[model samples]
Target: MQAPVQRQCSHVSTCELFPKFGLRGSLRVWQVFYCLGNFEGCARYRLSCEGRAVPASLLPNGRELNIDALVGKP
Candidate 1:
């Protein structure tokens, strides 16, 4: 039997939020749902494709992230 292919966002390596996702366990869900799956539905992916500025706080579900809180910043 053949192994199933895994689809991931092409910009994951360059994405600012990609690395941050690993810092918090809760953020992993976003990576699993968007970075590794359904990347086409990601807001960041869509913005990048359109040559627009993708905000670091933008989430795949079109929500803004309070990353500072997640990372213990003031």
Candidate 2:
């Protein structure tokens, strides 16, 4: 018999991809992977239209939030 798999979120409540806006607003890690299409593909995801790297956050328009100003020069 095959062993059962234990699926869990790697970055739940840690990563900045999802903000904690009440109970219904935040997203789980699985949701991030679902929207991203692949687990290993987030680094390549666009941080900004002007080409910049920033912390992860999703917008109401279904776009990645670019908070370079908030993070401020790594």
Candidate 3:
């Protein structure tokens, strides 16, 4: 058996992470990772996508919402 290679994306995206702002107050780098949000019972499975860099204050007003209300949470 062998490990598979990852894919890349050429666009920006918005995703939800737990405890809202898990990496708050910082800029992120882009990569492919599984998000534990964006679906019902989000953590059970993986939501794969490009892990684009986002800011802690990326959300409006820079305040961390309990959940990414615009989308939803895990």
Candidate 4:
């Protein structure tokens, strides 16, 4: 009585989990993120599968990274 793979949602828009199978009941790893938009292109913000050390561009508004939103203690 389990769900199908495609129907599963182990990944979040910000970060994702590996092991497409066991991911059903496991904690996801922490992957730090940088600003998405840049003077170049959005693809530049994309992370590599290897998770290598790459320089990322930081944004001022970061319209996405609303630190206050993350700290949901209200």
Candidate 5:
């Protein structure tokens, strides 16, 4: 018999298949990143669904996260 399917949550934190999808919307799209190490320490780095733009505070390890450079022309 075939196994039953499961539904995934829209939230980035609780979902395991988050990487398979892009953080897309009418204003902007963001690449979903999963922190493999130190989940507690990297809690602040997780992207928030509250805004269209990528927050500078979400930067991890002082690395430059340029959203404009990553976005493609529509």
Candidate 6:
């Protein structure tokens, strides 16, 4: 028997937010839930498909992240 194939977001390699998901343990859920799981539900993926610009701070859930605040930047 063959193992089931895993479905991942095609934009994972080009998505700016992809690399940031690994920096913190709490952020891993995004990768598991969106990047690897239900990518169709991801806001970034949706925007990309529509030919819209995806902000670097945009989360998969359609929430904008204040990256500077999280990273302690001015």
Q: For each candidate, what TM-score against the reference?
A: 0.93, 0.29, 0.18, 0.20, 0.29, 0.88
**Weakest ten-residue segment in model 2 by summed lDDT:** 18-27
Report how far residue 22 has shifted in candidate 1, in Å. 0.4
lDDT of 4 by residue, 7-48 (tens): 222223433222221233322221212222131222323333
Ordered by lDDT, highest first, the candidates read 1, 6, 2, 5, 3, 4
1-74 in candidate 6: lDDT tens per residue? Answer: 99988899999999988878887778889999999999999999999999999999999999999987656579
Error of 2 at 39 (Å): 1.9
Q: Is candidate 1 or candidate 4 better by TM-score?
A: 1
Pairs with steric clashes in candidate 1: none
Clashing pairs in 2: none
Ranking by TM-score: 1, 6, 5, 2, 4, 3
lDDT tens digits, residue span 3-64, model 3: 76544322224443322434543322112232321232222122232344544333322344
User: Stretches of candidate 5 above 4 Å error?
Assistant: 1-11, 14-34, 46-57
Task: Tell me the spans in candidate 1 whose CA falls farther than 4 Å from its real position.
Answer: none
Clashes of each: 0, 0, 2, 0, 0, 0
Q: What is the lDDT, from 0 to 100, of the residue 67 in candidate 4?
A: 33
Q: Single out the weakest 10-residue window by summed lDDT for candidate 1.
A: 63-72
What stretches of model 6 exceed 4 Å from their correct place? 72-74
Q: Give all candidate RMSDs, comma-separated.
A: 0.9, 8.5, 11.7, 11.6, 9.1, 1.4
lDDT, residue 38, model 2: 47
Higher-ranked by TM-score: 2 or 3? 2
> Model 3 residue 72 lDDT?
46
